[model samples]
Target chain A: MSDTPAGGGAGTRRRGRPPRTESADTRDRILVAAREEFSEHGYEKTSVRGIAKAAGVDSALVHHYFGTKEQIFEAAIAVAFAPTLNAPAAIADGPLDGVGERLTRFIFGIWENPTTRKPLLAIVRSAVNNETAAAVFRRLVAAQLLRRLAEQLGHPDGELRAELAAAQLVGCAMLRYVIKLEPLASADLEQIVARIAPVVQGHLTGP
Target chain B: MSDTPAGGGAGTRRRGRPPRTESADTRDRILVAAREEFSEHGYEKTSVRGIAKAAGVDSALVHHYFGTKEQIFEAAIAVAFAPTLNAPAAIADGPLDGVGERLTRFIFGIWENPTTRKPLLAIVRSAVNNETAAAVFRRLVAAQLLRRLAEQLGHPDGELRAELAAAQLVGCAMLRYVIKLEPLASADLEQIVARIAPVVQGHLTGP
Candidate 1:
């Protein structure tokens, strides 16, 4: 049996590492490194070894934490989308009539958060560059985020409507934050949400 | 000064070389080579020498044709967007009431065209991956395409609305063609356009 951490040995416990209090910390470290690597090099070029190296851990340790590169990437994206995903529920708890304003505000607030925005930019950039990254991004948007948004709206074509809403929101982010187009780029977040939210709301609940 | 082709020296012209014709051919060749190079290797990895080699021309010829890599990329994108730029006019000439169908057909036609689609995929991929590429793409979309669509629509918020329409079209393309998601990936073009065009036209014409 090979002594390497990644290679499983006969009669050895499948879970090699004993549970540690710092398990979450190690997982987060791997995620951070993966985000940076994926952002800079994209999915096709980014390797597990490379992420492991960046995280200052053995490749096997990375596998121990995330299992595979795709799994790690999914986890990273889940984390990235969490704020937006959770926002709808939070906004729903508020006034239903002001859903548009609340939704837009929630979106802009999350995007304006630097910690969230930077990793998101990386994911967005990487997704555009590589097919694999794009697939992951699309899945998250379609399955998790858009699906939830559609469920909230409860329209007949809610899925499609939700996707359109997402496209508008994401497209604005792409231009303002990632691409940094003029005028729109410099516009205040509040101004943007105020202007655009109605359109999003119309899509969500219009006839 | 320097005798290199890129330097544009004032020395005696070569006899019987047909400088103008050769230069034009070189420029076209470089653009073609650049499209393929950028598509395959992306903007960062593609080089002038590599493009020149692909074109079977001298490196100096590439520089002479296009001043820099950035200029070449811009030219390539301009070429890619050309199909869409002319599309509005073509669709405009058709029945005004069926503008949505005409527009949808035109967009799907271009995206379905293998010749155009490959380079487009490259451009989109690069734009998503690299900041420079994203900036260039955003500028092209904003200035040329979105502005024209807005002008044609003659809406009060034409610019923003046009951008919103563009986001729908581009986002769908990104998912169907680039990401190759289920259902959308295999769905018939007519069905997709039928479903999507009204939404797009709504953004353009408004109720």
Candidate 2:
């Protein structure tokens, strides 16, 4: 809710410079601020104004760049899962025999790292708390990741097959990370891959 | 708070009823109240006093019957999952090969029904919202359901296997029921059972 200025507008831009498209740095700041806000206050309580203030931009700029709360949420989750979304392309190049092991390892490996895990935890917690957020998150996951993976699998029921595989991984993440249930929580990563790979394989390629 | 019936502490009972060990009706009322309070306020903000007030019983009686808030939470969830907890025994009695179909059908059947689903949704939402609630939920699920299911499976890592199976179902539920993702959400119950049963069977009985 900052004022435009004495001359009106250009509040977030430099004083002497001509107005221009938002800088990449500025865009990154907004996304980071949005992640923190969504994590701290959850999806329902967070606002564009809050994200803008946190990023040192105006709400108008946030709106201009991201359009709506749902758009911003989708953008935020896309960034968070960017690393994850890259995997299916790489994994598809691999032989189908090891697809399950590679896929499981790839997903859980991302989760085992604190850097990727933190943003993901934020996205999941927000999504779980609100249906609107869940819908947004669901859209991003299906479009960006699961659908692509499904296409690679080449099943008649490819999307459902992809989703079932995803459901297994999502459930493991909830149990191991979010809920921190013992046994599964403390099980070795490689061991988890060994155990869960076949189930994922069966989901994707089973009769 | 109601005046304590002259002797202080039998307000939930009618005067001259000479209070026995809390009637079944009173116990059921308290359980129902606890479920509602936990559902509406979530685990962190819900209070014993709130539950007692909702049930029209004194806080002391709630404490006396259920002990602490955690215990009460467990009791509340136990009631919610009572039907589920019974499934392991029944399924174990059947041929091991049919275990997956029976288990999947049994679980999704409960979810397909509104009567059992309402309480379960409450428990899942509460658990998802708070770590304390998650931990409590983890313990109850492990102790009551997964362990029994695992014991019957006769795998060395039976607990992990059982948890892995639960994780897939839990994830599917979150997506279909909680997130209301399309296709999966609107998918037929028997179709889901048919699709997912083999993976569950693989998890339990596979090498």
Candidate 3:
């Protein structure tokens, strides 16, 4: 609620030099702040002003960069899944025989990173109960990842197959990272990839 | 805050005689009431009094029957997963080769039931964001189901394998039911079973 600035404004303009576009660093800071806020307080309780304050920028700047809370949330999801958003392309480069392994490795690889896991865990946790958050998460997965992959597969029920594949991976992530269910939570990475790859391969290549 | 008796205590003592045990009908009524209250308001917001009111009983009766909200929540999870808790046995009754189909069919069967699905969804949704609910839900899955299944597998990384298998099915359920991701949401039952059963079987029987 306070009209606080994210940065001192002095730091952003200390050189008194104008850049052609908004500083990427500033925008990045806002995104990071938004992610933290949304993860902690959830979608409903988080406010742009709160995010701006945490980001050390004015609320107007947050507004200018991301129009609405929904927009900011979408951006957060995009950032969280950024590494794997183009997973279809990554899996395509791989042979069909090992597509499951490649896809499993790629998706889990992003999830294994501490840097990305935090926001993702938060989003997954929130999306479980909140429809709006789920919608954004669903849109990204269906549009950017799964459906894109499904289109490339010239098979019957490709969409359903693609989703089943996604479901397996999503479920694994849910249990391993989000729920931290025993054994799976502490299982070695290569071990999981070894077991799950074939299932994914089946979903991708199977009729 | 209101003092109310469940079922007017009339059905239990129509002959004006005390019963040997708590009325099964009364206990069942409270459970149904608890499920609705917890689903709608979530764990923290749901109170004994509220549940009692919904069941048309006194808050003291809720406490007398269930001890605490946590206990009641645990009962709810148990009831929701009853069909699948002994899934190993259910699957065992069938051929090992078709175990995946049996398992998948069993879990989805429970999920498809409207009576069970409502409370299960609430618990699953609540568990995502709420640690306490998650813990209760987790305990039931780990101890009663997945871990039990793992113990019987007697394979290398058996527990992890069991969980990965669970992740596949759970993830599918989350997307199809909880998140309601489409194509998946509308996909035919046998089709999904055909696709997912192999993955589940692979996890169970594979190395």
lDDT of 3 by residue, A8-106 (tens): 444445364443234676787899999999989888778999999999999999989889998999997799778778788888995678888999998
Best by lDDT: 2
Each prediction's TM-score against the native?
A: 0.78, 0.84, 0.83
Query: In model 2, which runs have C-alpha deviations exceeding 4 angstroms?
Result: A1-22, A56-61, B1-24, B57-61
Looking at model 3, the pairs that clash are: A6-A56, A6-A57, A7-A56, A171-B171
What are the fnat scores of the candidates, in the order listed?
0.24, 0.56, 0.85
Could you tell me how far off, in angstroms, the CA of residue A107 lies in candidate 2 after the best superposition? 0.8
lDDT, residue A95, candidate 3: 67
Ranking by lDDT: 2, 3, 1
Q: Give the TM-score comparing model 3 with the true structure, all chains together.
A: 0.83
lDDT of 3: 0.81
TM-score attained by chain A of model 1: 0.84
> What TM-score does each prediction get for chain A alone?
0.84, 0.86, 0.85
- Residues B53-129 of candidate 2 have per-residue lDDT tens digits of 99999999899889999889989988888988888976877799999888888888888898899888888877876
User: How do these models rank on TM-score, best leading?
Assistant: 2, 3, 1
Residue A177 in model 1: lDDT = 75
Model 2 alpha-carbon miss at residue B111, Å: 1.3
Q: What is the lDDT for A174 in model 1?
A: 68
TM-score of chain B alone in model 2: 0.86
